[model samples]
Target chain A: MIRLQNVSKIYKPNTGALSNVSLHIKAGEFVSIVGQSGSGKTTFAKLLFAEERPTKGEVIIGDWDISRIRQSEIPILRRQIGIVFQDYKLLPRKTVEENVAFALEVAGAGPSRIKKIVPQVLKIVGLSDKLGRYPRQLSGGEQQRVSIARSLVHTPKILVADEPTGNLDTIHSMEIIELLKRINEYGTTVVLVSHDRDIVNALKKRVITLHDGEIASDIERGKYMI
Target chain B: MSFFLSALRIIRFAFQNFFRNFWLSVITMSVFVLTLITVNALIFINVLGSATVQSVQEKVEVSIYFEPDTSDDIVKSAQGYLLGLSQVRNVTFVSAEDALVAFKEHHQNDAVILDSLEEIDGNPFGSALVISAWSPDDFTFILEAIETPEYQRYIKKKDFTDYEAVISKIQNLSDRIRIGGLVLAGFFILIAILIIFNTIRVATYVHRDEIGIMKLVGANDWFVRGPFLLEAIMYSAASTAIMVGIVFLSMRWLEPWVSTYFGGIDFSAQQFFLDNALLIFGSQFLVLSVLGLFTTMFAIRRYLRV
Candidate 1:
C-alpha cells in the first residue's frame, strides 16, 4: 500500500542522502528495511513519513501522493502513520498514562475516549500497572512500550518503528520485535527499519536492503543479507 | 474539538508547564516585576513632582501696599478690581488695622523691634491687597491689570515674592524627570526583552524533545504551540499579580515618609494607583503578555518544523 518511484534526497552542497530509489510493499506486509549506518535507510523511512522531502520522484500511499505534501497537511498525514523512534521518545515529565493519553488528546479525542483507549493500549504493552510512573522512573523496555502505546492511539494503518530496539538489550530487543510482529498480525502495515542482523534474521519476513541511497535487494521471507 | 475543551486543556498544560519549571518561571517573573516596578515608580515620581509644583505655586502671592495717606475705600476698590480679573485666583483686603496687628505680632519675639513699633504713635502699616494668581506667569498679567492710572496713584509698593529660583528649580526637575523616565524606561524595556527572550529560548530548548515527540505522536500545530503561548500569558499574569501586591505594600509603607520629607505635599502614590488601578494594571499586563508571547513564539518556530 506504500510505493516510492525513483525517490532521491539530496542535502546542501551536493550531499545525496538517498539516490534514485524505487520500492513498493503491499498492504498488511511485515517488512524490514535494513542497512548499515550512512546507507540511507533512515532517509528512506523519513521519506515515507514526509519528514524529509525527496529531491526527485514521488511517494504514494494507496491512491494519495504525498511527495510534496503541503505543510498544513503534514499533521493529518502523521496522524495516519504511527512512528516510533530509536530513543523511545516519551515526554520526560509526563507519567505513563499522561504520555499515552497525550496522543489521543492531540488528536482532539475526548477525555472519555482518551481514558478508555490509553488504559487498553497500556495494557496491551503490559504497562497498565506502571501508568503512574514518569519516563525517568521506567526501564528502557517499559519506556519503549509507552512510545508504542502512544503511536497506536490513532489506530494508524501503517506503523514505522525506526530502530525500535536500538537502545535495548537482546532480551528487550526481542520483546519489541515480537510486539511489532503482533501489531502487524492485527492487519496494520509494519515497516521496521534497523541495521541489527540478528533481529532481521529472527523475523524470516520480507526484507529490503539499502546500499548508499539505492535499494540493493528485496526478498520475501528474507534474512539479514546485506 | 470544541473551543472550550481545547482551551481548558491548553490552560491545564500551561499551568503544568509553569509549575514544572517553577524556578525558571520565578526568575522570569522576577525580571518582569522589576520592569513593572521601574515603570510604576517612575509614574509615582512624576505625579509627586507635579503635586509639589502645584503646592509651591499656591504659596506664592503678590502684596500691593497703598500710599500712607490713601483712603481705605481706594484700597477696598483696588481689591475689588484685582479680584475681577480671571488671572487672579484669590484677592484678600488686608486693612490698615489688620496690617498693624500683623506687624506687632512679627516683632513680638524681639524687644528692640517691639519698642520701635511702639514709638510710632499711629499705625504705620498701609492697607494692602494680597493677590494669588492661577500660575506664576499669570502673576504678571494680574499685577499689570491692577496698574491702571486710577489704581497706581494710590499704590506705594507692589511686591511679587522672589520665587523665580524655586520655580526654575522645579522646571529643571520636571524636565529631568520626563527625559530621564523615558530613557530609563526604554533601557529597561530593552533589557526585559532580551532576558525574556533568552528565558523562553532556554525553556524551549528544555522542551525540544517533548515537542518533537508530541509532533511524532500526531499533534497539530496548535496542539503543540498552545501550551507555550498560554504559558507566556500565565507568566505575565502571575508576575503582574505579584507586582500589584508589592506595589500596594510599598506604597502604603512609603506614604508617610514621603509626606514628612516633602512638608506634607500630599504625596500619595497609593491613592494615585488606586484611582487608576485598571489602567495601570491593564496596560502592564498587556505589554508584558505581548512581550512574553512574542519571545515564546520566536523561540518555538525552529522546533515546530517537525
Candidate 2:
C-alpha cells in the first residue's frame, strides 16, 4: 500500500519538482508513472524510497509515514522497498554474486542464507551463469538484471523501477519490462517510472501521467497519453 | 552471530579496499613511517645530547691547592671536610710529593718548564684536594660550603672558575638542543597531519560513488563506515611495524659509529631504544592510529551523508 497526500517538493530559488501531488495505490498493484524529463516522475519515485523528502506533505507506505523519516530509519525503510535505477548502480569491482549478496549482507544475513539466496535471486534475473563476472564485464542488460536481482534479494514488498530501461535497447528494455511484470505476478507491488511511450502503452496497466509537477491523468489500462 | 558475521565481513572489506588501492595505501603508509622516523630521530638526538652533557659534567672537578707552608694535617682535614658534604661526589688528597711528580711528568715534553720547576727548592708545589660533585651546578654550592676561614687561609688557589664556564656552556647547549628538537618535532607532526588528512580525503573521494551506492542499498551507516575506519587502522599498524624495523636497523647500524664518536660518554642510542622499545613503538602506533582514524572520519563524513 502506498499513499502521497498533497506532497510538494520545491527546490531552492523557486524551482518545484513536484507540487500538490496526491495519489494512492493498494498492495500488489502494477502501476506505471510516465512524464517528460522534468515532469517530477523521478521525484515521485524518490519520495517512495525516502531519497527525497517532500517539502510539504505526507508519504505513507504500508502503515508508516516516511515524509519525514529519521536518518537512522532510512536504511530500515529501504531494505523493505526494492529500487532499481537507470544506471544499474552496481559496484564495478564486485562480481554479480557479490553484488546481490551485498544487499542481504548489509542486513546482517548469515553467510549460509546469503549463499542460498544470492544464487536463487540471480537465477530469477537470469544472471546465474555470470555470477563470477564483474559489472564491467557484463552487457547493459545483464548489468541491469544484476541490479534487479539485488533489489529482489530481500523479497521487498514494493518494487520501484526508476527508468530501469532508459539505457537499454528495445530488446533489453522489453526484457527488463517483462522481468518487472513477472516480479509483479509474484504479488509484490510494482511501481514503474519511465518516459518511454511504447513501454508505457505496452504495459496496459494503471497509468499515472504527470505534467509540470502535477498529475495529468490516472487511467486503468491507460495507454501512453502525454 | 549476525553481528560477528558483519564484523568479519567488515574486516574482509577493509583488506579488500586496502589492496584494491595498493599504491595509495603504500604512499599513505610511507608518510606515516617518515613521520614516525622523524619523531624517533628527535628522541635519539635529545637522549644523546643529555648524555654528552652528563659525560662532560662528570669529568669536571675543582682542585683546591694548599699554601706551600700548610701542614699535611691541615690539608688532610680540609679533604675530610670536603668529602663529608652531600654534594661532593669524591675527594682525592694529592700529597705535595705526588703533586711534584705529576707536574714533572706533565712538563716532561717541555725542557724550559721542567727547568723552571727544578729551580724551586725541595717542593714548590703544595698538597691539593681535588673534588668532584654530583652535578655541575652543585659544584658552586659545594665550593661555597667549604670556604671556611680555616680552609680559606691555607687555600692558595681555587681552580673552579674555568670549569664553571665550561659547565654553563654545556648546559646551555643541552637545553637548546632539547628545545630545538621539540620545535622541530612539532613542525613535522603538523606536516604529517596535513599530508595524512589530504591522503585520506583523496582516497575517500575515489570511493564516494561506492559509498553512495552502499547507502542506497540499505547498508547501515556504520556498515558503510566500518571498512574505511578499519582500513585506516590497518595502514597505521603496518606503517608502525615498518617504522619499528627501520628504527631498530638504523640504530644497529649507527651504534658503533656513535659509540666511537662519543667515546666513554656512556651513551648508546641502540641501548636506549632497546630499553624503551615498548613505550617508544607503542606510543608511535597509538598516535598514528589516532591520527589515521580521525582523518578518515573527517574525510569520509561528507560522502557518508548519502
Candidate 3:
C-alpha cells in the first residue's frame, strides 16, 4: 500500500521538481510511472525511498509517514522498499553472490541467513549459475538481474524499478520486465518508472502519466498514452 | 549481531578487499615502512646523540689551577675539602712535579714542545686540582665547593673562566635532543597521514562502484565507510609493527658501535636500553596506533562519505 497526497517537492528556491501531486496504489499492484524527462517520475520514486522528502504534504508507505522520517531511520525504510536503477549499480569488484551478500551484510543479516538467502535470490533472478561472475563478466541484462537479486535479499514489501530496462536491448528489456512481473506475483508491490513506450504498452498494467510535474492520466490496465 | 561479530566481519571484508588489490596494498604498506623507518632513524640518532652528550658532560671535570708558589700541603688541604663536597664525585691531586712529568710524557712525540719545556729552569706547570662531578647540573655546586677561603687564596690566573657557559651549552644540547625528538615524531606522523590519505583515495577510486552499490542497497553510512576505514587501519597497524621491528633491530646493531666510540658515558646505548626502551616502544605503539586510526578515519571520511 502506497499513498502520496498533494505531495510537492521543491529542490531549491524555485526548482519545483514535483508540485502538488497526489497518487495512490494498492498493495501488490504493479504500477508504471510514465513521463518525459524532467516530468517528476524520478522525483516521485526518490520520495518513496526518502532520498528526498516532499516539501509539502504526506507520503505514506504501508503505515510509515516517510516525509517525516529521521536520517537514522532511512536505512530501515530502504530495507522495506527495494530500489533498482538503470545503472545496475552492482559492485563491479564483487561477484554476483558477494554483491547480494553485501546487501544482507549491511542489513545485519547473520551469516547463516546470508548463506541461505543469497543463493535463493540469485536463483530467483536466474543468476544462480553465474554467482561467481563479476558485474563486468556478465551481460547488461545479467548485471541488472544481480541488482534485482540484491534488492530481493531483504524481501522488501515494495520494489521500485526506476528505468530498470533503460540500458537493455529489446529482448533483455523484456526479460527484465518479466523478472519484475514474477517478483510482483510473489506479492511484492512494484513501482516501475520508465519512458519506454513499447514496454509500457506491452505490460498493460496500471499506468500513471506525468506531464509538467502533474499527473496527466491514471488508467487501470493502461496502455502507453502520450 | 554482537559488536565483536560486527567488527570481525568488517575486518574480514577489509582483508579480503585488501588482497583484492594486493599490489596496491603492498605498495602502500611499503611506502609506510619506508617513511616510518626514516622517522625512527632520526629519533634514534637524536636520542643517541643526547645520551652521548649527557655522558660527556658527566665526565667534563673542572680543573682548578693553583697559584705558582702554593705549597703541596695547602693543595692537599684543598683536595680534602673538595672531596668532602657532595657535588664532587672525586678529586685527583696533580702536583707541579707530576704535572710537568705528565706533560713531558704527552709531548715526547713533539721534540719542539719537549725542548721548550726543558729550557725553563723550574717546573713551569702549576699543580692542578681536578673535580669530577656527578652530572652537568652538579657543576654549579662543585664551583662553590672550590671557592672556599682555604682554596680561594690558592686560585691562580688559569681557573676555568668558561665552565658555566660550557655546562649550560651541554644542558641546552640535551634540551634540544628532547625537543627534536618530538618534532621529528610529529613530522613523520604528518607524512604518514598524507601517504595513507592518498592510498585510500586510490582505493576509493578503484572501488567507487562498490560504494555506489552499497548506498543503493540501503547500506547506511557506517556500512559504506567501514571497509575503507578498516583497510587504512590495517595498513597503519602493520606499518607500525614493522617500524617498531626496524627500530629495535637498528638499536641492537648500533649498540656495539656506540659502546666502542663512547663507552665511558653513563647514558650509553646499554644504559638507555635499560632505562627507556620498553617505555619508548609502549608509547610509540600507543602514539602510532592513535595516529594511524585518526588518519585512516579522516581519509575515509573525506573520500568515502555516501
Candidate 4:
C-alpha cells in the first residue's frame, strides 16, 4: 500500500512539478496514473521510491515514513520497489541472464540462489530462451521483458512502470499491459504511469488523472478522461 | 553476503571492467610504464654522471715546480710532507734531470723542439711535485698547504690546475639534468593522473546507464564504487609490473656498455637497482597505486549519487 498526503514539489523559482496532491492505493491494486507531459505523474511516482522527496507533505509506504528517509536507507527501499524506465535500462555488456541476475546480486543473493531464480523469472517474462543474448541482440519488447524480469527478481511489493510500452508497437504494448495484469494477479501493487489513451481506455481500471500538478479526477474502474 | 563473498564479487567485477575495456587497460598501463621509464632513466643517468664527474676530477692534479737548483732530497722531503695529509691521495716527485728527459719525450714528435732542448740548455726543467687528492673539493686545501714559507721560496711556478670551471660545469650539468629529469617526471606524473582520471571517467560514462540501473535495482554506494577502485588498482599494478620487467631487462642489457663507457671510479647502476629492488619497486607501486586511487575516488564522486 502507498499513500501521499498534501504532497507539493517545487523545482525552483516558482516552478511547481506537483502541488497539493493527496492519493492512496490499497494493497494488490493495479492503478494507472494518467497525466499529460508535465502533469506531475513521473514526480509522483519518484516520490513513492524516495528518488525525489516531497517538498511539503507525507509520503508513507506501508507505515514507512519515506518522506524523511536517510540516504543509506534508500537502497533498501529501492529493493522493495521495482522501477522500469522507458528506455529499458539494461547493462549493455551483460547478457540477458546476467542482467536479470544483477538485481538479485545487488540484493546480496548468493550465486546458487541467483542461478536458480534468474531462469524462473526469465521464464515468467517468457525470455528463458534468450538468456545468452545481449541487449543489442534483442528486440525492444524482449529488452523490456528483461527489465521486467529484473524488477521481479527482488519480488518487490510495488512495481512502477513509467511508460513501459512507450517504445513498443501496439501488439507489444498490449503484451506488456497483459504482463502487468498478470503481475497484478500475483498480488503485487502496480502503479502504471502513462497517457496512451487506447491502453488506458482498454484497461478500464482505476485511473487518476492529473492536470496542472493537482489530481483532476479519480474514478473506480476509470476511463481515460482529460 | 559474507565479507569474503563481497570481496570476491568486487574483485570479479573489477576484472570484468578491466577485460571489458581491455584497450583502456593497455593505454593506462602503457602510460604508467612511460612514467616509470622516465624515473628509471634519471636514476641511470645520475649513476653514470657521478662516475664520469669523479673520473674527470681524479684526472685533474696541480703540479708544483720548484727552483732548478732545488735538491732531490728537498723535493723528496716536500713529497713526503704532501703525502702525510689524509686529503692527499698520492704525491710523485720528479727530479730536474728526469723532468728534462720527460720534456724531450713530450716534444719527441717535433725535431726542432728536441734539437733546441739539446742545444740551448743543460736542464731547463725544475723538480716538480704532482699532487692528487681524494676529492676535487680537497684541491684548494692541498694547494694552499704546499704554499707555506718553507716550501714557497723554492717554488718557481705553481700550475694552479684551474679545473674549477670544468668541475662547476659538470656539477651544473648534473644539477640541470636532475632538475630537468624531475620536471619531466613531474609532467609525466600529471599526464598519468589525467590519463587514469580520464580512464575512470570513460569507464563511468560507459557504465552510466548501468550505474543508473544498478541504483534503481538497489546497489549500495560502495558496491557501485568498489569495482572502479579495484580496476584502478589493477591498472596501477599491471603497469608497475611491466615497468619492472623493462627496467630489469634494460639494465642487464646495458650493464656491459655502462662498464665499457664509465670504466673507473667504482659505480654500477645494475647493482644499485638489484640491491634496492624492493624499496624501488615497492615505493613506485605504492605511489602509483595511491595516485590511481585518489584519481578514481575523485572521478567516481560525481556518479555515486545515483
Candidate 5:
C-alpha cells in the first residue's frame, strides 16, 4: 500500500516539482505514472522510496509515515522498496554477480545466503550466465537487467521504476515492461514512472497523468492521454 | 555471523578498490611514504643530533692548574671540594711529578717539545685537578662554586674558556637543527594532508556513480563508507611498512659512513632506531592512519548522501 496526501515539493527560488498531490494505491497493483518532462512524475516515484522528501505533506508506505524520514532509517525504507533508474546505475567495476550481491552485502547478509540468492535473482533477470562480466561488458539492456536483479535481492514489497526504459530501444523497453508486469503478478506492487507514451498505453493498466506539478487524472485501464 | 560477513565484505571491497584503482592508490601511497620519510628523517636527525651533542659534552672537561709553590694539601683539598658538588661528575687529581711524566710522554715524538719539557728543573709542572660535569651547562656553575678565596689564591689557571665556546656553539647548532627539522616536518605534513585530501576527493569522484548506486540499492552510510575508510587505513599501513623498510635498510647501510664522518663519536643512529623501533614506527603508523581516515571521511561525505 502507498499513499501521498497533499504532497508538495518546491525547490528554492519558487520552483515547484510537485504540488498538492494526493494519491493512493492498494497492494499488488500495477500503476503507470506518465507526464511530460518536469511534470512531477519522477518526483512522485522518488517520494515512494524516500529519495526526495515532500516540502509539505505526508507520504505513507504501508503503515509507516515517512514525510521526514531520518537519514539512518532511509536505508531500511529503501531495502523494502525496489528502485530502478534510467541510468541502470550499475557499478562499472563490479561484475554482474557482485553487483547484485552488493545489495545483500549492504544489508549484512551472510556469505552463504548472498551466494545462494545472487544467482537466483540473476536468473530471474536472465543474467545468470554473465556473472563474471562487468557492467561495461554488457549491453544497455543487460546492464538494466542487472540493476533490476539487484533491486529484487531484497524481495521488496513495492517496485518503483523511474524511466527504466529511457535509455533502451523498443525491444529492450518492452522486455523491461514485461519483467515489471511479471514482478507485479508475483504479488508485488509496481509503480512505473515514464514519459514514454507507447509503454504506458501498451500497459493498459491504471494510469495517473500529471501536468504542471498536479495530477490531471487517475483512470483504471487508462491509456496515455497527456 | 552477519556482522563478520559484513566486515569481511568491507575488507574485500577495500582491497578491490585499492587494486582497481592501482595507479591512484600508488600515487596516494607514494605521497604517504614521502610524508613518513620526512617524519622519520626528522626523528633520525633529532636522535643523531642529541647523541652527537652528548658525545661532545662527554669529552669536554676543565683542568684547574695550581701555582707551582701551592701545597699538596691545598690541591687535594680543592679536588675533594670539587668532587663533593652534585654538578661535578668526577675529579682526577694529578700531582706535579705525574703531570711532568704525562707531558713528556705526550710530546716525546717531538724533540723540541721533549727538550723544552726536560729543560724545566725539578718537575716545574704544577699539580692540577681535572673536573667533568654531568652536563656541559653545569661546568660554569661548578667552576663558580669552586672559586672560593682560599682555592682562588692557589689557582694558577682555569682552562674552561675554549671548551665553553665549543659547548655553546654545539648547543646553538643543536637548537637550530631541532627547530628547522620541526618546521620542515610541519610543512611536509601540510603537503601530505593536501595531497591525501585531493587523492581521496578524486577517488570519490571516480566512484561517485558507484556510491549513488550503492545507496540506492539500500546500502547504509557505514556500508558505503566502510570500504573507503578501510582503504585509507590500508594505504597508511602499506606506506608505513615501506617506509620502515627504507629507514632500516638505509640506516644500516649508512651506519659505518656516519660513524667515520663524526670522527668515531660514540653514537649509533641504527642502534637508536633498533632500540625504539616500536615507539617510532608505531606512532608513525597511528598518525598516518588517523590522517588518512580523517581525509577520507571528509572527502566522501558529500557523495554518501545519495
Candidate 6:
C-alpha cells in the first residue's frame, strides 16, 4: 500500500539524508526500518507522512502522490496516516481523554462520535484506566500509550512509528512492541523505524536496513544486522 | 450535527485551556479589559466635547444695541430688515426697562449693587435686539452685516468684542477636540495591539509543546488556531459587556445631578443616553472584536510555530 520510486532527500549540498531509495510495503504488513543514527530511516518516515517532501522522486501512500502535496492539504493527508514519535507529544494541560479527543476534534468529529470513539481507542492502547490522568501523572509508557491512542482516533490505514519505544525501558519497550503487533493484526499496515538491534531481531518481520543514505538490505523475515 | 458539535468541542477546549492557566488568563483578560475601558472613555470624552461645543453654539446670542437718538419706529423697521436675513434664526426686542429688570434679576444676590443701580430715576441703558444665529460661523457673518453703514443708521455701536472672542475660542476648542480625538484613538489602539500581541505570544510560548504535538498528530492549522481565536473573542466580548454596564449605570446614577448643575443646558441625561446608545455599544463591539481577532491571528502567524 506504499511505494517510493527513486526517493531522495538532501538537506543541503553535503548532507545527503536519503539517496535514490526505492521500497514498497504491501497492505497489513508490519515492516521495521532499521538503521543507525543519520541513516535516513527517520527521513523516510517523515516522507511517508508528508512532513518533508522527497527531493528527487515520488513518495506514494495509498494512491496519493504526497511528494507534491500542497501545504494546505497536509492535514488531510496526515489524517490517513497515524504517526508515533519517541517522546509522547501529549498536551500536558489536557487530561488523557482530552489528548485523545483532540485528534477527532481537529477532524471535526461529532461530540457523540468522539465520546464513543475516544474511550474505545484508549482501551485499545490499554490506557482505559488512566483516562482522567494528565501526561505528567502517568508513566512514560502510559504517556506513549496516550499518543498511540491519539493516532488511532482516525483508524488510519497506515501506522508509522518512529522509535516509539526509544524513551522506554526494556520491559516497556517489549510491551509497546506487543501493542503495535496487535494493532497490525487488526488489518492496518505498520511501519516502524528503529535503531534497536535486539528489538528488530526479536520480531523477525520484513526488515529494511539503511547505510549511508542507501538501503543496505531488504529481508522477508529479516534479522537486525549492523 | 457534527459541525456544531465540533465548534462546541473547540469552545470547550478553549474554555478549559483558559481556566487551566487561570492566573495567566486573568492577567491577560484584565489587561484587555483595562485597555478597552480607557479606549471607550477616550471616545466618550471626544463625543462629550463635541456635544458641549454644539450646546454652546446653540446658546450663543449676539446683541445689537440701538443709538440713543434712534426712534422705536426705526428700530422696529431695522428689526424687520434683520429678521429677513438668512443667518438670523431668532430676534427678541428688549426695551431698556426690560433689559434693566433682567440684569437686576441676574444680580439679585448683590442687594448693595442693586440698591446703587436703583438710584437712577430713568433707565440709562439703550434697548437692544438679541439676535441668535444658527451656528457660530453665522454669528460672525450676521454681526458683520449688522455693523454696515446702511444698517448703522438705525443701530448704534454694537460691542461684540467679548462675544466674538468667545465664539472664536469655541471654534478653536472644537477643532482641537477633533485632532485630540484622532491622536488619542491612534495612541491607545497602538498600545492595545502591543499588549494583545505580547500576551498572545506568551500564550503560544507556554503552549509550545502542545502546538508541536498537535501539529504532529495531524491537527490542521485551523484546528490549532481555533481555540486561541475563540479565547480572544471571549475576552473582548466579556470586557465590552462589563464596560458598557458600568457606563450605563454611571450615567443613570449621575443623571439628576448633572442636570442640576446646568439648569438652562436643557440636555436631559435620558436624551443623551438614547441618542448615543447604539453608537457607543456598536463602536465598542467593533473595536474590541477586531482588536481581539486580528491580534490573535497576527500572533499565531508570527510567534506560533510547530
Which predicted model would earn the best lDDT?
2
lDDT of each: 0.86, 0.90, 0.81, 0.84, 0.88, 0.82
Give the lowest summed-lDDT range of ten residues in model 6 chain B. B262-271
| lDDT score of residue B118 within candidate 4 | 72
Better of 2 and 3 by DockQ: 2
Q: How close is each model in CA RMSD to the real structure?
A: 2.0, 2.3, 3.9, 3.5, 2.6, 4.1
Query: Against the true two-chain complex, what DockQ does each candidate achieve?
Result: 0.74, 0.75, 0.56, 0.67, 0.74, 0.59
Model 5 gets an lDDT of 0.88
Ranking by lDDT: 2, 5, 1, 4, 6, 3
Q: Which stretches in model 1 have alpha-carbon errors above 4 Å?
A: none
Worst 10 residues of 2 chain B by lDDT: B113-122
Q: Local error of candidate 3 at B85, Å?
A: 3.7
lDDT by residue for model 1 over A139-223, one digit each (tens)? 9998999999988988888999999999999999999999999999999999999999999999999999988888888999998
Clashes of 5: 0
Fnat, one value per model: 0.70, 0.75, 0.59, 0.73, 0.86, 0.73
Clashes of each: 0, 0, 0, 0, 0, 0
| Weakest 10 consecutive residues of candidate 1 chain B by summed lDDT | B160-169
The positional error of residue B246 in candidate 2, measured at the CA in angstroms, is: 1.2
At residue B35, candidate 6 shows an lDDT of 78
lDDT-better candidate, 2 vs 4: 2
Best by TM-score: 1
Identify the superior model by TM-score, candidate 1 or candidate 2.
1
Please provide, for model 6 over A133-181, each residue's C-alpha lDDT reduced to its tens digit, 9 standing for 90 to 100.
Answer: 9899999999988988898999988999999999999999998999899
Per residue, candidate 2 scores C-alpha lDDT tens digits across B170-224 of 8788789888878887897788788878877887888899999999999988899
Model with the higher lDDT, candidate 1 or 3? 1
Q: After superposition, which runs of candidate 6 have C-alpha atoms over 4 Å from their true positions?
A: A12-14, A108-115, A219-226, B1-24, B51-60, B68-86, B100-121, B147-151, B201-212, B219-221, B246-274, B295-306
Q: Which CAPRI quality tier does the interface of model 3 achieve?
A: medium
lDDT of 6 at B257: 73
